[model samples]
Target chain A: MPRKTTIIGILGILLYIVGCYDGLLVAPADRFMGDIQRIMYVHVPCAWNTLVCFTISLVAALGWLLSGARARAEGRAWKWDELLEATTEIGVVLGAFLVVQGMLWAKPTWGVYWTWDPRLTTVAVMELMFVAVLALRGFVDEPVRRATWSAVVTLVAYVNVPLVYFSVKWWASLHQVQSSPSTVDPAMVLPLRINAFAVLFMSIGLMGLRTQLARRQRQALLGESDSDSTASSGGAA
Target chain B: MTGVMQGHFDTVLWVYGLTTAGLLGYFATLLLRLRASKAPTSGQTRVSAQNPEKTS
Candidate 1:
């Protein structure tokens, strides 16, 4: 995993450099928004990846709950708890980053940092729910209970993601509808694609590192040896 | 010309500022973590050197 992360890191850096050069040096600015259109390359990708992270987290939480029940019934003993923790941690970090980036994008495009738009408001609520899940984990000391409850929160909070995505479409709003990839000019779209790939790899890499760190912390709480062979269960509290 | 130019100016500044800040924040976090990971190893080395007699 460490080797894989290193390789991903190297690739991420190389791609990002190439991407920046393409965005700044090679591509021409938009006639409409001019230099500001360049913001889409970064802003749009962050938004997409943030949604992607949340969706993965929701699926992982559901998988954990189902697998845990099966493990208990079959007496197979799975480590779904660790999986849940890792997924939630990744979800929260990416979710937070998404909002920060969105606010940055919004302040310019909308003429305000925040304006009670449905999509923005719903996404903020979803991000808060994620924080609540983490707080719940912190308050619960018992491993099994923490994992089970957090999984539940993650699963429930996931319903808001679609609401956030569809809010602009369903109501009057300042937020722009998603750009059609087919119609995007090649010069503009190329950097956007590269940025998306870079951010995705970077997000995954950070999540992988966080998962391992969370696992380590869990082991320490359980009073286990520092060896990698130590079993990982609920350790968030 | 003035009205159209003003319209784009604030938006352009806002986008650039926010995106730069976001990217910087992420980069700062990575650096902080890297620093933290190194601290323990460096501390252990210092401890061992300072108290070689305590080494078992």
Candidate 2:
């Protein structure tokens, strides 16, 4: 809702367009996979952004817990809780994008749409775990309890995040190990990096908007609760 | 073996199309939720249950 957030989000959309153009037209096609390799530009960026968003959620969870008690008394804890919800939602969206993109690429390159590859499997697990955290939030009604429980569950789900990154290296799999400038063609790296930054900008913007929405919703709930209590007390008087 | 040698333009198109559409859809929903939250209502409690963000 903030001007800065909108600017960054629109800027990200612009960058995504440019990045896609570069990947689709400027970057050379893979000799093996041909034009299908272009999917890597968006696919790799989504993967990186998904991890980044989840990492933000992890940090937000820690913030909520570490600043507990005193922060709660000071009424400062909701900021962290709001952030946790925001980033977790965005992370889920990006992770879903990452999986679907991976599947689309796999269909042509690996002869199938779905595979039990190590990295792929771990990524799926990671996405599901974070999604469960979101569902946990929906089930809990109390503000403090929802924040506390989701934070704890986030901590548990975060264990698989590292595994997702390292799964390819630690196991024999059809998926390639992490890509680097040294490993990938130099030309491909530019658009890939562009999309990476684009997605990061977009994530930050979306997170800010989401956190703002949470704050407004909480404020409305608290207002309603206050009025209800006041009305009951007035009736008793 | 020859799977990688076939036409894959459609696959690439689908990847980009789906991701772009998904992210945009999410952004639109967030914007709508924000607007809904800002909207003043008489039975304010119903906002959470019916609204999209549902961060209650």
Candidate 3:
């Protein structure tokens, strides 16, 4: 685990350095966008990472729910539920940042911070769903119950991600369709492709770190309870 | 710079500023929760009583 973390961390740092330097310095300014288009380097990566994180959360949520159901029948739950919770929590954090950055990018390019365009609207919905999942976890006291419900919600809400991606194509929207991978020139593609990889690596690193922190907290909390139980029983005896 | 340039720069700064603050707030919350989770229980069952879901 430590090795995986270190490798991902080093790769992310290198990729981020190359991506930021090349994107901000070597890439050409847009004909229409001027210097403001530099926002794309950061904004686009955040957007991509959000989607990736959300998809991972959705998969974890599915595992949580399915495994939990089996565990309920068998009267045992494995330790994997903690992993689901950790991933979903990290995804929400990254997803929230993505939305904020996307809006920031919009203020300059789209002339308003927000629009009711399909892509933005769908992403907004997705963000809210994440919020709901977190709120649900806080509401329930039973770990199993919380895990089951949050997992269910996470899986259901994940359907919005693809909708958000396709929204620009499916309907009229202010946000520009993907220009780098498909229609744009080779010059634009270089930075974009590299940046995408950089963000993916960074996302993995962040997710791993966040999940580790979460599991540590879970262990600490459970350990405290076990100690308290033992102490009280001894006193009673 | 001209007024338009100043205006655009102001918007850019605000966007980055708010985002930085938001991220900081999130990290702080996570750290605080983590710390609370590790606090010793002092042979008390209040935590589980207070947070029953966490217990069973």
Question: Which candidate has the highest lDDT of all?
Answer: 2
How far is each candidate from the true structure, as Cα RMSD in Å?
6.0, 7.0, 7.9
Show the colliding residue pairs in model 3.
Answer: A141-B53, A142-B53
Ranking of models by lDDT: 2, 1, 3
Q: Write candidate 3's Cα lDDT for A137-181 as tens digits.
A: 788755556667878888888888899889999999888896556
Model 2 CA lDDT for position B39: 31
Residues A1-237 of candidate 2: C-alpha lDDT, one tens digit per residue: 478977998889889999988988899888788899999999888888899889989999999888746566555667788899999999999999888888888876778989888998999999999999999999986677787899999999999999999898899999998876668989899999989888988998898899988877766655534223221112211
Error of 3 at A61 (Å): 1.4
Q: Runs in model 1 with CA error above 4 Å?
A: A69-79, A225-237, B2-56
DockQ of each: 0.16, 0.32, 0.16
Residues B1-56, candidate 1: write the lDDT tens digits: 42221244355445545555665576567556544542223344566679998543
- Rank list by TM-score: 2, 1, 3
Among all windows of ten consecutive residues in candidate 1 chain A, which has the lowest summed lDDT?
A228-237
Classified by CAPRI criteria, candidate 2 counts as: acceptable
For all candidates in order, the CA lDDT equals 0.65, 0.83, 0.65
Question: How far out, in Å, is residue A2 in model 2?
Answer: 2.0
lDDT-superior candidate, 2 or 3: 2
